[model samples]
Target: MPVGHFPLQDKIVVITGGGSGICFSFAQLALTSGARGILICDLQLTPAAQDLINQTPDEVHFMKCDVTDWNDLEAIPPKVEEAFGKGQVGDVWIAGAGVFEPKWSSFIYDEEKEGGYKAMRINAEHPIKLTRIAMRSAISVNKPCAVLIVSSGAGITGQYAAALYCATKHAVVGFTKSMGQADIDENCKIVCILPGMVSTPLWTGRSDAVASQFSYTDEVCITPEDVAQGMKEMIEEEKYPGGSLMSIAKGKLRNVLESKLAFANDGSEIYKQFESKCYAPIREIWNGERGTKLS
Candidate 1:
C-alpha cells in the first residue's frame, strides 16, 4: 500500500502524547489520509496538540492523560470509542511521549538531586504500561491496529553520556520483541523507530551534543515532519514487521534485521565480547522465565 492508500478515509485514529513533536505532525498526516476522527491525548492539555487538530477536517478531540498512570491510560479506549461511534479503532499511534531531562544524565554525578526514578518511570515503565493496555484493547476488537513507538538512535547504539535514556530505549526495543508474537493474531503490529535527531522543541539546547555523538552534519539532522512521514509510510505499507527496528534519516529507511549483522569485527572487539559474556544470563532469564509469563 502507498502512503495514503490504506483506506484512512473515515477511519478512527488515536494518538497518545500527540500534543507536539512528530506525533502532532502525524495527526496532520492522518487527517490528510482521510481519517474521520482523531483523539489526541497528552500529559497535559497543550495548545499545540489542539491547534493541529483544529486544522483537520475531521472531528478532533483532546484529553489530558498521563501515560504512566494505568487509570489514565485505561480511560482512553472508552473515550475513543464514544467519539468514534464505539467499536474497533482503525489506527492507533503512540507518539507523544519522550524524555530528555538533565537529571536522567548518568553524567550527572549528583544522584540525590538527579531523580533517576523519574526517567525510568516516564521513559520506560510508562510506555510499557501504555503498550500493554493498548494491545489488550485493540486485540479485543480484532481489527488491524498498528503501534508506532518513537525511539531514538541512541537506543539502538548506546551513547556515552545518555546512559539512562539509552537503557530505557533498549527496554522498549526488547518489549517490542517480546510482545510481537502475542499481538500477531490481532493484526496489532508494533514498530520501533530509531530516528536521528530531529528539529523540535526538545532540541532547543540539546542538538550540539547529540550531533557530536551521532556524527551528524548540520544538514543531516531531520525534522519532525520527516519522522511523521516515515511513520505514515510504515503504517500504510506494513512492510516492516513487529520486531523490526527502522532507522529513518535523510529520507532513507533501513531495516536493521535485513541489512545489518548483529556483530562486526572491530579493533576493540569490546562490544562483541560484552554481548557474548553479558547476554547469556539475561537472555536465559528472559527466555526461561519472562517469556513464559508474557506468552
Candidate 2:
C-alpha cells in the first residue's frame, strides 16, 4: 500500500448519497478508521444508514440534500460546521450520489419526461457543483481536502441502452481529469473512481429500473463493500494523486489512464489543425479581442 497524503483519522467527512450503496459502505468504514465526524447527506435515509447514525449518533450525522438543487448543495458547508463545529472544513468530500438512467428521466423517453434529464443533473452536474463548493470551502480555511467523485464503468465504456447514464459518467471523468491538470497541492486534491457493475441498490434492488440490464453472472458483480474498500484505499493507503481515475472491478483496483480510458485522442496532424482552428476564435475572444458576454 502506497502512503496516502490524506488520512481519515480525526478528520471530518461529508458524503452525498451516503444513505446507501458505495457511499454508505464508505461511511461505515470511515468510522471504524477513527474519523472524527461524518455528515451523510442524501434525499432520505436507508434503514442501515439510520441504524449506523443511531449507533454512533455523536460521530455520524445525516442531512437531507437534493444534489440537483443548488440550494441544497450551498447549505452543506453550514451543515458541516453545525455538525462538527466551526472551522471544520471537511477533509473528504465524496460526491457519491448518482442515478443509473431510469425510465422517468431517460434519454430514450426524453419527449415524455418533463424538465431536463434528472440523471444528468444528479450524476454530472451535482459532482461538478459539489467539487466547487468543497474545494473552495477547504481552501478558504487553508486545509487539506480531497474530493472523491463516484463515476461508473458506463462513464468510460458506452452502453447503448443507457446513453444518458453513460454520458453523465463520462462527464465526470472528463471533469475530474481536467481538474487534475491544475496545481492541486495549493488548493485541494480531487480523484474519481469508476466502479464496474457493483451489487448495490443501483443494480440489485428490484425497484430499480436498471436492475434487469445487469443480468450478468454473479462472478462479474462486485459488492458495494468492494468499491468502498477501494475508495478507502484510494483515500488512505493508495494515495492516488490529484485528478487520478481509479477503477474498481472484479475485486481489484486499477488506475485508469486518462488518455486511453476516458478520451483516446488520436494525435493526428489533421485533428490538431481542426482543434486549433476551433479554438482560435474562442482564444481570441478570451483575450478580449471579441466581447466576452454570452448574453
Candidate 3:
C-alpha cells in the first residue's frame, strides 16, 4: 500500500508564540508538510516569525499578540476567519509562549521583578485562553480541528527552584485533559506535548537550572529541529488525541517506572482480568452488542 501524504495540505493553521524557538521550528515543519496558510502570533511581532514565512512555500502571516491578553486572543478568530474567507481554523498550535524563570526560597515566593507573571501568563493562562478561542472558531466553521499545547516535563514532575514554571506547566496539562473531554466532537482533538529542554533562544542568557537538572556537559541541549520533528510526527500520526505525548532524549523514551512495576500476582492474571472484564466488555458494547452469551 502507498503511504499517506502530508495531511495538513491547505489547512489554515494558527500558532501563537510563533516568532521564535520551538514554535518557529514547528512552523517550518508545517510548511514542508503542505500547510496552506499559517498565522504566526507572538507577544511582539518579531521579524523571526516573518523570516520563517519568507522561507516557506506556504502562505504565512505574522501577528503581534500577547497570549495573556484575552482581547488579543478573542480578536484572532475573526482575523483568521477573514484571511481564510471562512470563520474557522482547521488546526491551531499553541507553541509560541513559555517561561523558565527560577523560583525564590518558598512556593509562595513571588518574583514580579524577575518576570514571574510573564511566565504564568504565557505558559499557562495564554494556552487555555487560546484553546477556547480556537475551539469556538473550529466549531463555528464546522470543521475538524486540532489544538497542540506545548508543555514541559517540569509540568509533569515538579522541579526544585522552579515552582512557578512547574505550576504553569501542570496547569497546561490539566487544561488539555479537561478540555479534551468536554470538546470531544468527531472533529476536534486536544493534545499536550511535554518537551524536555530543547535548544532555543528562549534558554539563551538564562540561568543554568535546565543544564544542571538534565546533566548537560555544556550549556547546549536538544535542538529546535529535534522538537520540530517530534511535533510533526505527532500531528501526522493522529493516534494520540487527548493525550500527553512526551519527547525525551534518544534512548530514553520509555516510561521505565511503569515498565518495571511488579504486581502482587503474575502479569498474565492481570491481563486476563483486564481483557475479560474491561476491554472485551467495552468492545462488545461499542459494537452494539448487549452482552456476550456463552452457549
Best TM-score goes to which candidate?
2
Candidate 1 residues 1-295, lDDT tens each?
Answer: 1122244567677787677777888887888887888888887545766666567524788878877667887888778777776564536656458776454344453453544456666677777777666666654554456676777777778766677778888887777765454333345667677787777656654644654554545476788888887777666664665655677776565545432224533646797687568556644543343212221
Candidate 3, residues 188-282, lDDT tens digits: the string is 56667777766776666456565465565423456777777666665555445544355454445322111111222255877668546644553
* CA lDDT, every model vs. true structure: 0.65, 0.80, 0.64
Q: Give the poorly placed runs of model 2, Cα more than 4 Å off.
A: 1-4, 182-185, 237-239, 259-295
Worst 10 residues of 2 by lDDT: 286-295
Stretches of model 1 off by over 4 angstroms after superposition: 1-7, 45-48, 55-58, 88-90, 104-116, 205-218, 251-295
Root-mean-square deviation per candidate: 8.4, 6.8, 9.0
Best model per lDDT: 2
In model 3, the worst 10-residue window by lDDT is 256-265
**Model 3: how far residue 223 lies from native, Å:** 1.3
* Structure candidate 3, residue pairs in collision: 17-96
Q: How close is candidate 3 to the true structure, as a TM-score?
A: 0.73
- State each candidate's clash count: 1, 0, 1
Sorted on TM-score, best first, the list reads: 2, 1, 3
| Least accurate 10 contiguous residues by lDDT in model 1 | 286-295
